[model samples]
Target: MEYKVIAFDVMGSDNGLIPAVDAAIKLLGEQKDLKIIFVGDGAALKKELSSRKHNPDQVEIYNTTEVIEMTDGIMDIRRKKDSSMVRALELVKDEKAHGVTTGGATAPFIAGCHFILKKIDGIERPGFMPVIPTVVKGKITLLLDVGANLECDPEDLVNFAVMATAYSKAVNGVEDPKVALLNIGEEKSKGMELHQKAYKLLEDHEEINFFGNIESRYLASGIVDIVVTDGYTGNIALKAAEGMGKSLLTEIKTALTKNIFRKLAALRLRKAFKEVAAKFDYKNHAGAILLGTKSIAFKSHGSSDKVAFYATLKMTYNAIKNDVVNKLKKALAE
Candidate 1:
């Protein structure tokens, strides 16, 4: 059939192969033109597929003798070439698949991609950038280096800005995505030397609409299209936002169900509340694209299940359709 091949690691998450298999089957039903390589234990995968009785033509399994676990480090990729994560990524490396997604350990996943796919030449290291959905309807912001480079040069930050800008334009349909450096304060001299240097580089960049510095407070306010930072700070920001999102969402539910009058009010705004909840549900698009890699590698949350895995499948499809890697190469070249 026509090749719209995608690869996924069936052994990536805590939920075993069930969620990945379910999502794969769902995706196959939704898109007939798609083909998938579910890389993992073949016997296990075949059992699951047999249970569902899906056609082998659409969803094929690549048997793996090894598996990279959460405790594995970067060197695990070297030792475990036959792992589901490595094997799935290999399909992308070999051009057998357009992209791959795995909810595996972050270190090995990045290591596997780096060791196999390599960086896109000009890129020093691949950065994990996630599109965060904001409270504003149809509004999303890109956050880069969420857990990639712990330390980065000013030019690296500039490259991230360039890459994310192109991604926003292609995927999110933003004409000119406003880019900002994440800083302790909005002032030019507020943070460390890295921020100062990166600020100058971004400010001087003609390609992106550099919006100076963006404090973390404005991240959820949807004031800018992209937020760039070193992984250390970015990771902190990501975790904090996640914790706050969960807390706030919990608080909302608790408050709404407090009494009869509030429950009645909640009943009235049920549709609206559900819509808002959906927007806040990052699990609905559960992953970040590893930009700067030779091939697209999607890193989903380790706990991701059926709905989350399905969301990453959609993300992989979008990245492939947009030719994200090539577009990023072109943008960085310019």
Candidate 2:
């Protein structure tokens, strides 16, 4: 499939922003008919591109007058009409590009996407889906509403499940992927009122493989392919997992360096540790996908390095080739 171009908001000053952009552009150059649109300060972007020896001809810049501050509140989105993020979103809405990629502030990205790209038919809101690495080899689990729509209604949760299920099948190549709702307990009546309603709705849906509620303990078991929850809880769970991973690594390092004998043992197992670290490395995973949007919009971590940015762009290309939007349309219709 011929993807016209991918739009990016190159307005952040995060340490990884420029390097990530350079890496993504380099990867996209290898593919045919794929162009990139850098929506930000034209002269600055040009200078950065030149410094990296990247050909300017392959990229189109939509210069903006205003820059959205990283600390700017979500409401600032309405005031920053000339911001680069807003301009990139407009390009997607205009069909000038097939998708958008950004490592900017999450609030502005979500606000701008909703304002410009809009939502798909029958979708009340656009939910975020972040692919988390699983214990299964070469496979990842999809976590919905990572940080968007904090207080979703029961119907909204059901919509998230539908969108997430379609996304997993279309992108992960999972046929009849198991879908689970994140709850405090595993029983059917364990969660709050919203969970009860969502559970019933999911259970009633004949098209989806709605598994029973899953407790947080089994989150990374690799048994369930898609886990649905409101953004508030999902974001907390994601951050908690990251913190735990870091703490575990720190403890292991401390234990290994306790003495020379143990240090020697650590050296022998260095390769094994590296292999294990690779599984938990967030850089290998791409950015979060904004589901239910008419056009694709991915929001990468602000601290994302070159590898993560490249993965995000590559995933965007794959999503376009897979016709994810069409698949979502079909599933929503059913």
Candidate 3:
């Protein structure tokens, strides 16, 4: 069987390289046809792997002298060209790897991808697309332009829908995915000029199943498969949802242990509470893809733990296995 090689930039993560290294070893154990190039401090990575029992043939380390910090500026990609993040991306650019994953700063990582991987043919601009869980269990929605481009035009939003729809079909197994424009109202005339214009274009586009405008409050209602918006707005919405989920879970925990009666009640409802908590856990959906790029450039959470990092690695592997980049090109061309 043929193997797919993935370049993992295992630096600049908030928790250090342990999470990424542990996840890589676990992934290699299950995926026999996969190889991982851990791009970071060679000695440190080798030391971490020494205690872990993994197939030596499936792992390699590419030592880098530098790392891109979270505080680094956007142009640091050029200044720190020898950094782990840049080296990992280069593996894909040089056709040595099928994809790359990083837990680096958002700006430099996205910028590096744009300059290094370049855009897919016919893609005007790349967007950040993340899979989000909906209110319905086991269902997900794709949100794009989440801090990729600060602003976008109507045509760019349409391109995001096209890219997202292609992703939904290929990876999510959703055929003819229904897409919506995130707006203040459900009417066609809602939102800014960009949203209004995008609504019309999405409606006219034959490739996508346009579901019209959807209010932000309804995002978790599981009414749409994909939601398109500008980066500025999408970023805020994503953060707000993440913060709200955490706040609600905290509040529930506090309420459960307030008194003797509540504590007793909590014991009886522990399983139910866990199920609800799992549905809203951000760790379950921690990775976001820099779509419209020529290769899969996955950005895991900067503060990811082993569980979150593993989820991202699985996502990157699935993207490569499903040939998502080529499918995206076909979607745009058609």
Candidate 4:
């Protein structure tokens, strides 16, 4: 029998295993086929489980005392092989689990993935792809190479687009996802030499629905389904977008309060505000899937709460159910 076990790195998060353990209990309650190997300090983990009323059959603990810190360098993946992050990667590599997730350090997590699970054939480097919400209701966009390869060549950008197309189809359920290069402008002549070369390649490629260039302003405009760029720019863009979302919420709250008339009007629009909040709630789509790896690997926000971790768990299950890795391999092969 194939057990759908997830190797969950339970350390290094903002609050450590409290949220992680809660998420595991909730997920195990939801997905009966699923089990999580919580890789961390065995004594503490067992104590947490003892407190919770979880079934012994569906939950297991993998003892590990070492944790990769955020300040740790990529070489630590080799030196700190006994760390929780590396142990989680080893579980996926050894087929002890179907997928792996970590709230640990991003650099070491990516490095551990490369050093252990290994990249799929033909992938120069694995890219971090996250599905973010757009202004358009019921629609979302996939941002690729979000924070992995900060410096990418034209070929790497092309590979990101191809891999993103596959990911969009599998996870977002878009049959013909419109792929676009994130650029300063929509014009072919705009941007630096990197996008200039990548633009020509995306246009010439017949496999994906190349939608020309997309300006950063339209990233949330729902104009395109997939935005491909180098990790540096993508990472900055993602953080900026997240910041803007917070600013918008803050501004809306300020506007809704302060006066009696406005307060009365806000009551009428409470449901509307809730609808919008749920629409752009980052927690609903938490975790970045590391593309180009041979096995399923995901990186969760270091400070994600229990709700966010639960969403990450669900996202992992969705990717696994869709056979995202093998499907991505087939797409890249074609």
TM-score of each: 0.95, 0.93, 0.97, 0.96
The lDDT for every candidate, in the order shown, is 0.88, 0.82, 0.91, 0.88
Clash-forming residue pairs, model 4? none
The parts of candidate 4 lying over 4 Å away from their true place are: none
Off by over 4 Å in 3: none
Question: For every candidate structure, what is the RMSD over all alpha carbons to the true structure, in angstroms?
Answer: 1.6, 2.0, 1.1, 1.5
In Å, residue 11's CA in model 2 sits off its true spot by 1.4
Best by lDDT: 3
Worst 10 residues of 2 by lDDT: 12-21
- Candidates sorted on lDDT, descending: 3, 4, 1, 2
By TM-score, highest first, what's the ranking?
3, 4, 1, 2
Backbone clashes in each candidate structure, one number apiece? 0, 0, 0, 0
The TM-score of candidate 3 is: 0.97
Tens digit per residue, CA lDDT, model 2, 1-334: 4455888877763753476667667776786667788888888877777767555556777788887777987777889889888888888888888888887888888888777788888888788888878788877788888878888888888888888888888888999989899999989999899899999999998877998898876767787998989889888888788778879999999999999999998999999999988888777674889999888888877777787787787777777767788888889999
Alpha-carbon shift of residue 199 in model 4 (angstroms): 1.0
Tell me which residue pairs clash in candidate 2.
Answer: none
Model 1: CA > 4 A from native = 53-56
Error of 3 at 314 (Å): 1.0
How far does residue 150 in candidate 4 sit from its true spot (Å)?
Answer: 1.0
Candidate 1: global Cα-lDDT? 0.88
lDDT of 3 by residue, 95-174 (tens): 99999999889999988998899998877779998888888766799998898898999999999999999999999999
